[model samples]
Target: MSTVLRSIRAAYCTQAVVDWLALEIETARPTQFQWLQRTLADHFGDGKRTYIDSIDADASGATTRFLVRLNDDHCRTVDTVRAALAALDQRHTLVGPALVKLLEVSLDFYPKDDQARAYLPLLVARLQTSLEAAGGTSHRLVGPTKRAEHLDSTDTPDPRRTLYINNKLDPLAWRVYYKITDRDQTLPRDQHRARVEFTLQGVGLHQYGINTVDDLAALDFGDFGHLLHFRQFKPLPDLIANMKPELAQLVQHATRRDRNMISLYPFGLHAYRRYNTGKHAGKPRNGGHPELRKHSTHTTADAELNQLVRNRLHDLTQFFTQNWNEK
Candidate 1:
């Protein structure tokens, strides 16, 4: 597997000098935001909006936030981020270092094998089930409503496409989704792969000790790696391998269809319940059905998937640290 820090949205809080200059720009030419955005974009890269693609200023002109997309191979470095900030500084002319605020980080994974492809959907389903199991009153699901006073322009998130773990307004919120489809030709045919993405946002970045670009540059795999998990659904043989002799015999004598059904757990249990009570034999007993359930279970994905994430995270960290020690 391979991983990349696909994007980040950070804000540069202007100091007093730039604040006055920004306010002056806003006053003299209320539409300078767009022009400034273009200037900064041009200064940072090819001026084609490929690197520092998004730029904007707040009402007070005290802060400017930009979205940086590390889309190209040459731009995947901490130096790129620093260069982005430097571009902003050169254009804004600040007296001191800009107060950097990280709003979100998107980590994208490209699976090399079929393990992640097979497991990702199941993993998402499990996460959704776990969230639903938490019930409605859970704070993880609830947040302030957006109304007349609290109107904010945000995309209506599609639950089917993205598995959001918590309310977006929470201190820390994240989501996972597959970014590529069969029709997507953004990359080469062999590289046309399952792009599983995990996004982290809000002040949770601070809680995770990611305060600055440098912190992100030095992030450890364990810092945010624990968020990804998988559940392995064992095969039929493994599911029933430990049953007692009589139980195993009862399971063994069952038809291949029934054995296959048993592998699915509770679904198969229903059929066995009827058989154990002699319902099929027209001699059903009152509450005589033996209790049966799936006992064998695994919490972790296969080793291949686990190591894939670890290796990819290492690669991502290496990208940030490659030019890190030089300057």
Candidate 2:
């Protein structure tokens, strides 16, 4: 399959929606967050609105946060933003059932973008109209008390600066990171760099009957080479098992090298086993049908099997040393 590339931008304040979408797509599930965002954007036309960054629900044990950035021009005073969020919270409590019902209906509708958008405006308008009909006041409960309190006259804010509802635990942070850092632009590039620190744990190979480091040291010669010499041997599984100690050591040493020698393990093993006399032939001569088609209970033990196993181990060791030591 050909590789498909996608470029994404950081969305401020819509972190919850972006995160929900990522999780849903990764797990092959459906989500309502995407629908809500699209619906709001379409109807509201990117209006200045305040959404809760964090909410603690007593009954559901659910915590919902917002990650959104404000447009400079539409930037209301902090007091206004806080008040708007409070109003939104009250609306959420009052319209909880309606919101859930909408989500359920939207879930059943396939081709979400196309179908959901069609009904979204109607839903939003209906919601507002219904609330008013129920005697709820349409008060501007959030945002600055006066329109003059707007921070900037700019109509649009920097789209790259993402606004999130939660202060930490950003689920969509990786997605945003890939977008901002890896995206293509027309401008000349300058060398920029950053560093990240992390920790990793290592495991030993004794779990696979390989006790003591010497058992690995002893197989440094032909024993490792024989494993890869097989023409048709599938070496991945065996190589992984045999080279655990060497790999663990590499991690311990923290080497920075791109070793290509490891490719030989699979290649050599596959090449050597391609023409082996046993399985390639149809006859039952050197074992049963050369394929070792079935284990004959009456047959005597053969030394070739042991040799084959030993050779495999040797090849695995060689692969590790060659690749792991490369600079």
Candidate 3:
């Protein structure tokens, strides 16, 4: 069986913070223990048991906890642990108290016993480097005060859908031919290469939110390789079926909203323009110094993806605010 081991050392102002975190983890949806169990079961054979190595909390100062032996055999144990931790961080943002501060988290992997202890120093150094880099807000938001105004002014209410199609003819053909080949026959050294191409097209109709398969189809995949494949391949349905009931519902709702926005391409563009321009005091066409303008133009492409992600996050925040109390 595969396994993952993790150790977390947290420095808190008081023991209260540690206690709160522990309680929060216990109460968390997809509880900490549940996450551990599910993760292990997904990767390893159906083993419901997880062994906790240690849980030490210093009431006088900070708290340190170690979680070892999370059985997941599919991938690198350390990487999986890191992913679980990151997911925990995101969940904390959604449900945790404002007082809880995650000062630092470090993760390491040990495929073999000999490599484990030696990696701690490196992990500490990496943590120190990240701490050193942490300072100040990276950027400030400006421009329109209201969301509707921003959306309207920027001319990006909703963007059009763009499709990216990937037809894996070669792989399918190879599998079909390979099945007929005798075991004694040597496999072909040079297999045919698969052809994958992206197609960008506007959705047929305008939709306020994404909530349906057709709505999701409206998302533009020209810019995002993954999204493009999703549009063409329609993998979400399969994924939803595989996910837990609650998670599947959430994904379905989110996917629909995402696709609806994509159907209105120019509107989405306008929305982003409104967000950026509203956050800052600048003209849509010209604002920054010539050099800054050149730099900003070069950076705008990257910003497109960022804005799309932020839009979705904003929607998610609104969702939680409406559904749950924030306090």
How far is each candidate from the true structure, as Cα RMSD in Å? 14.1, 27.9, 25.2
Report residue 130 deviation for candidate 1 (angstroms). Answer: 12
Reference-based TM-score of each model: 0.51, 0.15, 0.17
Error of 1 at 153 (Å): 32
- Residue 120 of model 1 has an lDDT of 41
Q: What residue pairs clash in candidate 1, if any at all?
A: none
lDDT of 2 by residue, 7-105 (tens): 001101011100111000111122233333443344336553422122333354333432323232212222322333334344333221111000000
The lDDT leader among the candidates is 1
Q: How accurate is candidate 3 locally (lDDT)?
A: 0.26
What RMSD does model 1 have? Answer: 14.1
lDDT (CA) for every model shown? Answer: 0.39, 0.23, 0.26
Candidate 3 lDDT by residue in tens digits, 1-327: 001112212210000000001111221332334444454454445444544322343443222333334322221222333344444445432233211111111111112333433333332222211111111111111212322222232232211111111222211100000111122354342311111111112221122232222332233321232221111112456656666899888877876777532222221111112224343445546552212221111111223223333343343333322333423
Error of 3 at 20 (Å): 17
